[model samples]
Target: MDSFPLGVAPHSAVTIRFVEALPDPSPVIAEIIGGGRSPGRADRYCAGPWGLTVVVGLAADATPAQAAKAGALAAAALIGEAIEEAVCAIALSTEASVAFARAFRARLFRPLSLKRAPRAEDLCRLGALTLVAAKPKDAARAWAPWQAIAEGTEWARSLCAEPGNRLNPTTFARILGGLGDLGVEVEVLDAAAMAREGLNLHLAVGRGSATPPCVVVLRWRGGENDAAPSLLVGKGITFDAGGICLKRAAHMEDMRGDMAGAAAVAGAIRALALLKSPVNVTAVLALAENMPGSRAQRPGDVWLGHAGKTVEVIDTDAEGRLVLADALSWGCATQKPRQVAALSTLTYAIMAALGSHYAGLFATDDNLASALLSSGEASGDRLWRMPFTPADDPALKSEIADLRNCPPVGPPDAMNAAGFLRVFVPEDIPFAHLDIAAMTLKAEADDTLPAGPTGFGVACLVLWLMAKG
Candidate 1:
């Protein structure tokens, strides 16, 4: 009777009646609530992985402080149990937001695993330990581990939610620059410099925007070895108005999320550095705003990529792959990373295929694909490998350039985009592309995770890098 009980099934509702007196509580509160006792609320409820519900009373004369403390303890009990299953959602209560935040952080103090749920003993042991503080709208205690996760998630949401004007390339660079304190060496390369390095594709995609383009790179050298690092290239279009081939206004505001892949990369670097993981990682973020002004590259244009290969512009909306092409070519040619992988919110086909839950991964190497598959599943940021083959390669063919950056036509737009990117990869080097259009944001919030900005790829990358370490 003293232990907390979980609802029988997922998201099943259980009501607890707490009043000044146990006897008075049932009839009076029940009349106001008009509900029968839920099946698992009684003292004799099952006690295996889940135990009986604990009922604590806050007297009618209780101060807000006392109620807050009771609420924190109650919330902690619920959240701690969720840590067992590695997932849970909390419906916010007006009076308990602060208390819930406090309790949520408390759950992480125990041997909680980000990779997955903890064992029963660890979960039970954690459920019993309590910080037990009286709370009245006090700021929640800064739980370092949870706070880092939270900051990255919240950062993603904020960046994604902002209007395009509020978050252009300069501001994007500033955002990366801000993370320097977290040990990421941030560098912002302007259009002139990118031009000097022959980043024509990046410059071509960005020319129409008045915002001026910039490429931000974040480097983290945490590993002991001075080996060639694994590179993560992100396609960062700060806002894609679709250039001369303008996107419909229906959901254009969501274009702010076009940079989400970059955000994921930055957030991953931030988390790795915050956790002080021993892995050397570098992120090449190509930041630009794709608009349809007179100066923008037209449909027939052909831009030279970093590897000195030309890419024909079949569609201006296929801009993400353009920026990523330059970034990948640059990262591979200069950085010479042992393995190169890039992430992007590139194509709508991925959204149609995987819905809004998973990322589409394209890899030339089966081992990298398998490793990412395992890491992604373990971290809750799942990725499904879509095909990138010789069969699909012809779909991206062009007469003017070495290859086109988009498919002429297909239901498998995601695959073609990946196929387009394959042209930039060196024959001997291994590469992968993550189409994260669907996985970057979530519709609702959860206890261990915030709602809007899921920071989907961050956890998977961290887990992968740690495994390498």
Candidate 2:
């Protein structure tokens, strides 16, 4: 793992000036500001002496969260690209100023780099940033939580961005083992162990790839010894070639990000552990690779899942849920958690429905759904609730099996996928499914997030767990 240079530093690095509202600027600052009208939010300028100056406009009607997000956006725009040091100069009430500074620092952080070659000059070598605040102590205190969340987000992004060849099931499990250093109890169940436990559904998905299948469980027991931990399951298909039902060539490269859900789960656990939050959390990652070799599971096949339910594979493209079935069942049955949440890039149908702005959230428990929704709103990993009515169940029914992997024909494909997963979890346990196919990757650059992996669920999940405590 590459080291991340994050935190407050002494006053020797480059300066990043952040203004809540622009005042009469000096001649040099004016030249950098240009003649363009200020949009009054997340405006950027390059003053020679200031290095990178960011002006964050806090509208009278804007909430503190919005103002903080704007500050983060402005700071994020300057991350990477060889800036040695930065100073955030913000003038607001001590409370608001501290919040803005913490958010800014979080955004300015960059994740682990995959670049192989050494550059002539350091690229993206930002060493440190100093926060100039009236209340330095308060700002320092606020920085801790945001720093943990940012590190988790960056970890997820780096994992998702890694190529399939480098991050196969074994390697991914190995990488996750490092979390044990942070006091997270780690367990890796290999293919032989899964077979012994009758995880045929998960094994079938990885039959085509030499990487094999595994379940990586991370346990963080920061709360009471006997507390029923909250469970998080992730679909970790490292690369999805759609198995026998192959995908088109146009965007096939993007399939490398199929394991984003697992990455998010891993990231969330890391954040909670780093913060030492007073809550017990467990993450079960179902790791696999879906390819189109002769041994791969094909359409029209039937497989018994970990829950002892039979599923008919109608389309090999819908493989994520098959692996998830095993992980969710195994986690819920063995651990017997109080609540469970699973994340997956399960369906393009979700992307078609919600686009890139929101992930589709389906939960059996209303309170769990509401808590996640509130967390999403607060963390900027927004989710839109999708109905999980009995009406959607008919699409999952099959003549020969308990459920069909994909609907024969339906407009609510996303809901149908959720409906299929709903069968695996017992009704007594509170469960929520997040179809994050849209949130895994981005097509356009935003103020805070760049054009690639967004690491969407890490912050939201961590915040929700923190709220539970």
Which candidate number would show the highest lDDT if scored against the true structure? 2
Give the clash count for model 1: 0
Error of 1 at 370 (Å): 1.6
- Candidate 1 is scored at a TM of 0.71
- lDDT per residue for candidate 2 within 6-118, as digits (tens), equals 21111112223333333333554455446563544455555655566655556434455765776677666555444666554444444555456546654554433444564
Model 2 compared with the native: what TM-score?
A: 0.87
How does each model score on TM-score?
0.71, 0.87
- The C-alpha lDDT values of all candidates are 0.67, 0.79
lDDT of 1 at 380: 59
Q: Please list the residue runs of candidate 1 whose C-alpha ends up more than 4 Å from where it truly belongs after superposition.
A: 1-147, 410-412, 443-451
- List the RMSD of every prediction in angstroms: 13.1, 4.7
- In TM-score terms, which candidate is top? 2
